[model samples]
Target chain A: MAFEFEYSAKNPLYPVSYLKLRAMHSRLEIIWTGQAENQAQGLAQRVEQEMLAMEREFNRFSEKSPLAVLNLKAAMEDVSVGEDLFMALELSEAFRRGTRGYFDIATSTSCGKDMVSYTLNPKSHSVRFNAPEVTLDLGGFAKGFALERVSRMLSDEGVERALLNFGSSSISALGTHPYGEWWAVGVDHTKQHGIVAKEVRLKDSAMSVSGRNYKGEYHIVNPHTGASVAAEELILVEGRSALVCEVLSTALYAAPKTEREAIVSQYDGYRASEILCGDCGSVSIRKIG
Target chain B: MNRKEFLSDCGKIGFAGVTLSLFPWLQSCSDKAKQEVKGEKARIGIIGTGSRGCFHIKHLVQMPNVEVVALCDNYRPHLEDAAQYYPKAKLYDDYRHLLEQRDVEGVIIATPLYLHAPMTLDALSAGKRVFCEKSMGYTLDECLEVYNKRKETNGVLFIGQQRLFDPKYIKAMSMIHEGKIGDVVGVRNYWYRNNNWRRDVPSPELERHINWRLYSEYSRGLMTELACHQLQNGSWALGMLPEQVMGSGHLVHWLKEDKRDVYDCVSAIFTYPNGVNMTFESIISNKHFGMGEQILGTNGTIDLVTGMYYSDEPAPKGSGMHQLIAQIESGVMSNSVFAGTSWAAESSPLAPGVPIMTNVKVVTGESTVGAEADGSRELLEAFIHATITGRQPEKVLEESYYATQFALLADKAMHENQILRLDEKYKIPYTPLK
Candidate 1:
């Protein structure tokens, strides 16, 4: 039957390439250019849907939900419990291993309470926590994991060639975005405006930069010294997944030069780069892959 | 009553429980309790009062609460005609001169595409609203410049994307958003007309400029003239911009390309963020007429028919025939048409033709349509409302910029035949269209 409108696909139908997706999510304007139209729209829609879904799934305020019940049950055993916050718990472990405890998810700072004090529980799709002294702040890595989830969602939707950027910095370039090479992503230099420190074209992975360059002395809080870690400047990293990029970028920034790579290598697929403030008017670009 | 007793009774309440009654369908509900407050009319001026300009004048005059106050054209004939049609209206030859006049509030530019950018920039600088016609400009840089001027000035600039004003597209877009067809996977916008890019009387000298759509200097061919509008419709509805765009076309059976640098069959693909790909095709060699967006979603594909002859909003059911018969009967009695209806089958009131399919039932036109078609009209009203009461429309300049940027990117792809990168924020900043 003749459809009311025409649903046309472009790319002139190439043999194989990638799909791309982008948004005004992260601090930087994001671009997710990829191949594979067979599942582009469906994939993009699902990514958005699931990102919002996870946010809802973990929100601790809903008292009637399974998360609340699990939180209450876990809290009964210990006033401050960390029984089963899967994404959060795993993030904490990765942070512990990657940062060597500087950016610890388990440790609480002046911002809120520690992960150990985050009375929480999870049963697969659900996670709950008791009224906490420590605020469960997933801001550091949630955006990246959300991006990783989006990447998987695109794959599940049959989109092989895709680039999904959660925000400007946290991005997962799934397939080669039509260039037959890695997607070219520019890392904005911290010191100046419109300055590009480096541009890496990535494939089959993702990259993230959590630095103190622009929003100075803001996000980074060093647990080891109980002082600001990334507060001075940018501590950036890239990886095969969101969690790795997030934790490595955070942990490696504060760790002594000798301990950084060993700490970051614990994760499966991750590489990192850093630019720190120097006394001699010289800035460095360090890559760990 | 006790607290529980009071709460239980609240569940069974009426006006007091009015909100509770809406609990079941709260997420997806429609309300007919609209309070219409009659607002101020939109003021409009027409520049380049050619036939198209006159038509716009006539259309605006017919619209409620809108007044066409001035007409501008280089040609004296159109200026004279404007005076005849609108006795009290001001007239000018140079659009720049028209911009200086305080009598007109906003201007409609139906001039050639090249003049659009400058005219609009002048109008915006002069603190007047603008509604300029399609392809909006001759070059990507020009389009960016004009649009940027609008933003920088914070003046109102509307592109005369009539399809955006057309009801068929609006309805289809609404349906697409409602997920009626489920996560739309693909959208195709195509326009095909059977006409050689040739002269009717073998006058290649003057013919190319008259049918401006035939040459590149004056236009971007089918993509800019026809496909630009359709592509905008797809990209806007999909809510994503295409990163890369490429075009492949041929002269086919048209005039030689030595004189005319326009394509007869051109198709462009715009891939959005989530891999939702939109394809725009324009073929001039065939008459089996077609133009509209084919949106393929997860549920069922929706087709947003727009801007073509057959693509008119699906006419209202039996109301169409009733209106047609009334017209035919009036025509016969009045003796207008040369083609006799004796050979034509009598339209039946008993068994009227089947109604056409569409995504969401929507109406078209600036007043009834969208902000893109009449920026200041809708936008001014909403802005005034917001300023006075702290409430405004959900969409804004950023939204329009996305649509504008999306169209230009795809156009650049067609023009350069290479994948254009729009990675940078406001990468190709120029003056605004407004």
Candidate 2:
């Protein structure tokens, strides 16, 4: 599935510059408008470069990646990570705690440890595992972190209008579309033939989508149970920060339907919804804040 | 360190690392060099005032450093039509007369396929740099003759396989070399156009002259006219010529027309030295598939036409917990892991085509040529730059020679019904047909 960053010169004064690239086995698009031509171009290039760097550092598939190296040595001894990896790990820890362990990153087929087994040293920018089984995978948090960073970069570059989409799952809108009042994003319902089940309009906001892994099996493995999430639920989170949206979306999807509202209420300026896919192909959408 | 300082340091390291690591080799031909060359103008001439010749004029007129000084064609109508575009250019009915113009430093040959070798030879012999339209010649002998002449005259020869200069293609090739897609295993290219492949003739005598592409004596039909670009791309991407070729062609749908001797459809498979095979298909009866080239590497597939690529393996995804986070964020859910053990069932995601040229914004709807046709303008610029600077484009002759050789051999393989290997004897001894 290829994704394109559609740019329009409809308003020449605010010409859009967009680039689409692949990273983390997903399509990422960055569209920037309302800046000087050269600045917009530079920001787009910087965004892509940052995303690729994050992929190189965080991707577990690459054995040479920083995350893989950390996963290898963190279990045995304290592993001093680079500044970027350390920050991402810190955010992962925060989300893991904030989601009450529902948003664990180590509960994979390869690494199955919860946040309690990991300890961070802020002064050294290092992490150590309390248990030998503890392993770190930043795949879940990387895109969100990258998006948030890119948004900051764009904003720093004085880009007043831009849209950063990391796959269809994570999106950050800075300002608004060149022509429209707000950056409108669609929430795709995969079970419903990948239709636009919901539309979100944002100005200086970020949104993330998490639900049915394209694979038919339970991809959302519960850290507490070590079992895959069986509930067919679609979760969407809109918040001021992409990382926050991503964390809340995943936590709510894994949390029971009754607990979703409570989980979302904990975060200010965060709105979430769950689309439950019933066995009969029926969908139930419940909104929460 | 604080979060802000850490983040800032990380961003700087990443930006520098990625920028330095990628595309180090492409730094040789910098925009500064192009701008330097663009400062000077080179006077050029156009021979064979046909559709392609006129297209060259259109792009040439737009170029800053190129002045179309002369136009030549035996056909009066084509000459007149081209003359309308460059009214001040010295027009001539004979190409030899056009070559005689002392001010014409370079010539763009977009005549019939059969005329490529002779026109290029004349142009080079006249001390004018040549940009000949592709399928270097009608036969192996003609191609060799031109290749030898280029070496003998020390003239700059750039064949019009525009894709060679296409930014998208250059970028794609760079990615392929960078192992972004791993090793290229195979290539599949097809050109499908729904047309009778005919041109209107003012007189019966002009039928053969005007529609030369449909005649075996003047052209190799789809192989030379259409498939050469794709074949050139395949060879370029593979960085080697085909060792052997096997293929077939048939009149198929256009048999009712007696004037046309060339086949309407052709298909060939070329095996390169690395054991990689390139499959080419062209048909004039269908336009559904349109035209595109696919370079299938072990890791990914690049669609040269669309400027996009799809990976063979699914993108490196985050863990299940990552998916759960995303699910919660999006407010949608279905099943857990949809990807089964069957790799075949899994679909790889498509990424936007990487830009071949750095520091150039790919703007859509600009008067600048579309991605498919931009090669012409780029090639023209390179040709003009070469003419003025006296610096020949790197590997253009060698690439052109191999592409033409492969094209002719593929046609031979199809007609003879045999797997033909490129022999040394074919490269030597330029035997001009009597």
Give the root-mean-square deviation of each candidate in angstroms: 28.6, 17.2
Per-residue lDDT of B128 in model 2: 96
Candidate 1 Cα lDDT to native: 0.52
DockQ for each of the predicted structures, in order?
A: 0.00, 0.02
Estimate, for each residue in A53-76, the C-alpha lDDT of model 2 and write its tens digit.
888888877899888887788878
Per-candidate iRMSD: 29.9, 11.7
Cα displacement (angstroms), candidate 2, residue B98, comes to 1.0
Best by DockQ: 2
**Alpha-carbon runs more than 4 Å astray in model 2:** A1-195, A198-289, B1-29, B35-39, B316-373, B428-434
TM-score of chain A of each: 0.69, 0.88
Candidate 1 at B123: error in angstroms?
A: 0.5
RMSD of 2: 17.2
Report how far residue B257 has shifted in candidate 1, in Å.
9.5
Indicate the worst ten consecutive residues by lDDT in candidate 1 chain A.
A1-10
